[model samples]
Target: MDTSGFLEWLKASLSSSEKTSDRRILRFVHPDDDKRFLRSLRAERPGSKPLRGIRRLGIIRAYSCPVPPEGLPVSFGGAIVWEEDIRVSTHAILAAQRVPADSGIPWGVRRIRAPEAWSRTTGHRVRVGVIDTGVDFDHPDLRHSLERGINLLQRTALPHDDNGHGTHIAGTIAAANRMQGMIGVAPRSAIYPIKAFDYNGTAYVSDIILGIDWCVRNRMDVVNMSFGMSTRSKSLLNAVSNAYRSGVLIVASSGNDGKRGRIDYPAKYPQTVAVGAINRKGEIASFTNRSDSVDIYAPGERVDSCWLRGNRKTMSGTSMATSHVTGAVALLLAHKPGLTPEQVKTVLKRSKRPLRNAKAPRKTGELDIARMLQVADKLM
Candidate 1:
């Protein structure tokens, strides 16, 4: 059917139904045609309210709008494409008991040998964007590491932690409290929390795309995505590719499905560095999604980090592993400020410590930050 006929049918269908419809994101084939198309859509239904929450995803040349069901056309003569705003969740699985804080560095931090390379570069001045739940801004351990961040959920509000997931990830990346609390891999690095996810640890695909766009525009050296979705979104992939081309290194979790040869989106995408989880015994975590696409593994089992109300918690997931790698990337960037994502990945790959368990065939080696720096030196 023609575009106008399709729009009329959609409106009639929606008017006949008693249920409310969910919002869908729309992408224009040519970004220049966006206004013309929107004008046409508005012209069809005169005096109707315009689309709300119209977020311009400049990187992907798309718009995330809450268009009413009646206003949404299935296809707009190939000028625009639309997709459901799919949900994405954090990869963290909280342990039953909260672990007491240890004044020294966490085992995961030590395992990666983050401290060994501190004398050379502790990720000084590197900017790492964390796209997840908001952070605990008042947490003492994270005070020095945080910068003013954006809250996509609430534009006027500071990106504060309603859920502890982001704080945990932030602490692992750059918690700088040295005397009474633990130090992270990149203690001097700056963390810019992008609150895309909510207190429920869930966010829509549009929100994540906005977060990635923010990262690219803000010139973040590295971005840590500790969450994943099972299905692929072309919109998300486009944003990732744009960010990668803009010199942003994205580190993402493989997933927690415990399935062999299957990983999650964003990580599964070629532009991102896909990471899986490992335990203290240096074996792959059974819960971690295994696949040949996984670029590396890191200590993820029972990791301790900052939580809400200035507390500490131990959580487990590939999310934790991705944070470790993010911090390590920050360290690399601090030492060699202009290394491309490809170069950074090569250094990590070259310096990885071989896993003891050969049974896990697809798993790559664990992170070795000290060795990574040595490898970087040789490239100079």
Candidate 2:
């Protein structure tokens, strides 16, 4: 939108108070008003004038909405979504690769590739929702970074990490351990655990939709979905679509069935970035499912991290890989303020760690951290 026209629209909205009588148009606003946009809510009714600073910028060509911006995707094709600001929190992206182990509950911090950039920034205040098996609040790797959570599956008052999958996924993306263990992709990031699966690895589509709806309503910068299914659900896709329109990033596992191109529900739905499994050796795990929807690969086979029952163990599947990408997306959100879910996907794909061969059996490449932070805005 033109600068003059945008200003004019804001002035008119403040006076009339409506974007349109029937719709809430969500798109990017200028830097000066982004913060205010988040803190302030539009009071105008559907048919009122419009909200101030809200512009009909049309489709943001800079970022791919995964699915197109008009309405929702045909088969979860795409949705119109936009992000407000960058949440740069340097404390959130630290890792634990080389840290020394503790005697009993010790965990080391894995150093991120670009410490210099983070050194100059405190990191963004990015809040990512972890929709998985639930997380343990006491895990050494995830203690301080833990924030709020919900249990959509059990409908409990508090959502705890029971299945261990959510905790590992949480640790990978936002665990903030300054003295020990590993730091996540966005170490300083806050985690909102929304448990949708039980310890038995079962969940209902209704619960998953609730989880996605919560993330969207709560304004989560990214949602870590470590589960997938073969059958498609209207509720699931609609929830995802609602989230996209609300500017929530959906990252899901590519499924662990290990079958060649076994179709997964939400992951296969074009609305999400489906992550595949990769071993420490950078090889795709044999059990990892392959599909045209697989967006990227990450450490999955026996990938070591926090586990269920307060245990630290190795687990496999695209579930682990999704956490890696989730963490990475959190980092980008922290530094690249104002990135749409689509733009974040764009940068990550561009920065991907190339596979050994483009024509190899596993075309998807490994996680690329260095290239991701190359264009981040300094938080400090």
Candidate 3:
């Protein structure tokens, strides 16, 4: 409900001119209110017109109007709240980290104990929705696990990765067949690419909400969001809440700001599993964000996975760590498809491997996917 960020930005932009000419964007309480408010604003302030808008769990509407210079338009009375729509990529430096062990599998794969997990379910029945830029549906390592997708930016059915970030995240979650020298934690899980970010890896909160809405409508088992923003958004929280209520497990990156302060939105929201990064040494990554909201740590430093153009590359970030946990969730869900979001969290917390040097209990250790599967089997 914090509309302060949006209001502050509007005030600064309006200060440049006595009467601003640009459209002011806002999230309304309802669709009917958005229509009625825009009609009233135009009637009272002439020349004001409604611009682009989208309605999901919340109503997002924008309008072009002349500022009064004295105060905000009366039409904005209760329809106004802080719009925390601006979100940035949580990816850290993109360089390869050398692995000491010569295990044929990627170090991250080994770090999460994924090979042992393969003996059980390989995540065959789970569907993970990657709400990032998009995925490379043709990449050899990911193509087999890739399923249908929707592009929110272009309003299309195919959501392809142009930024390469989404492909990396997707590959980490469900790469299959050891193709192109890579294997994901949940190799057999289906990945549904929900393209919310653009080529620059930038996404708005509204776009993310739309993507989550799509996932809920499609009944996706889990959603992986490897991005973060500093602000708390109402619409984003509403979308996440609705998704969780609908039985979808959500995972997100704590952030890569390297700060000990609060983590990012949606992840900070209690319903999400906020993940931080650990390096090859099993120590917290130097760039990983720390906070109570972070639920677990995973291998993220210099991790290699599928990339654009059927190639592979090493990247580091809580984004990569988030993908590992997403795959782990798929593995658990494949065995126990009826588990609720709270049940999934409990299993993950119960099966976590303790880290000797972890700063706190929250970042105590990495995910033990094999152990998680064993626990799931016992529960069944």
On lDDT, the candidate that comes out on top is 1
Instruction: Say which prediction, candidate 1 or candidate 2, comes out ahead on lDDT.
Output: 1
Each model's RMSD to truth, in Å?
3.3, 13.1, 5.8
Tens digits of per-residue lDDT, candidate 2, 1-380, equal 23334334444544643323222223333543433333333333234443432332212211111111233323312222433211111001112233233322211112224343456332358888987777888788778777777876456467886556677777767656657565565677788898777776666555566677778767889898887766665546656766777788899887766778664768887778878776655667677787767777777765556755555655566777787778777767776767877777677666667765445454456666666676343221
Q: How high is the CA lDDT of each candidate model?
A: 0.87, 0.60, 0.76
Over 4 Å off, model 1: 1-19, 35-50, 67-77
lDDT of 1: 0.87
Best-to-worst order by TM-score is 1, 3, 2
**Distance from true position, residue 92, model 3, in Å?**
3.5
Span of ten consecutive residues with least summed lDDT in model 3: 48-57
The residue-by-residue lDDT of candidate 1 on 1-380, one tens digit each, is 24455445445544544646676777766745765555555675554333333566767877676555555543664766788778999998865466566656999999999989999999999999999999999998999999988999999999998989999999999999888887888999999999999999999999999999999999999999999999999999989998888899899999898989899998999899999999999999989998888999999999999999988888999999999999999999999999998889889888889898988663378999989999999985
Better of 1 and 2 by TM-score: 1
